[model samples]
Target: MPKDARNQSPELDPVIHPINRLRICATLYSAGATDDRQMKYSTLAELTGLPADTLSKQLKHLEGCGYISRAREYGSTRAKDTVWVTLTEAGAQAYVQHVEALKAMTEGL
Candidate 1:
């Protein structure tokens, strides 16, 4: 629990924010657990159960928001590029803050 978890604005209403969406962000960022590296789309899908296309689109949105980075790589083939996703500094901070915010909302009564 965070030091400030006990304090939060009821008006913020974290339930509306939902857990799974947050889970997607947090879990993906957890790739930092090993060498602060990134992960692939298939890897994330295995963890989050979000379809590839769905994850791709949502990831693009996160990238647009400056929360995540998306890179496309060529594998010596003419087909679509393999994707790599990583958390930017902004993304890591946002994940931490979002977790803190949600923890505050769920603090004991």
Candidate 2:
């Protein structure tokens, strides 16, 4: 457990602390463990119940932190382009650790 500035308790991961980010992480963490580890951007947006723009912004943050990878594939036509996202190994570990931290925080309460 990592301490915050006051060193009172384990600090929650800022990256995954937001509700939307936590939802995204949990979704990706479960899916990544399956045979099909990749998901379409649209599918993820649907799963997270977030608008396209919001999802894009959140995804950019996660990608910036090396938690996930985004790949854009273009079809023969311009409108056929599709984006796919997958969790990196680091992301999996982070998700597990975050879940454990959450559990610890609630254990004694």
Give the number of the best model, judged by TM-score.
2
lDDT (0-100) at residue 105 of candidate 1?
64
Write down the lDDT of every candidate, Cα atoms only. 0.66, 0.80
**All predictions: root-mean-square deviation over Cα?**
4.8, 4.0
Which regions of candidate 1 are displaced past 4 Å? 1-20, 33-36, 78-80
lDDT of 2: 0.80
lDDT by residue for model 1 (21-102), tens = 5666777767672225778766877898888777777777777877778767878784656777777787777777776765
| Model 1 clashing residue pairs (backbone) | none
- Each candidate's TM vs. the true structure? 0.73, 0.83
Residue-by-residue lDDT tens digits, candidate 2, 7-75:
554657888888888888888877763224689888888888999988889889988998888888998
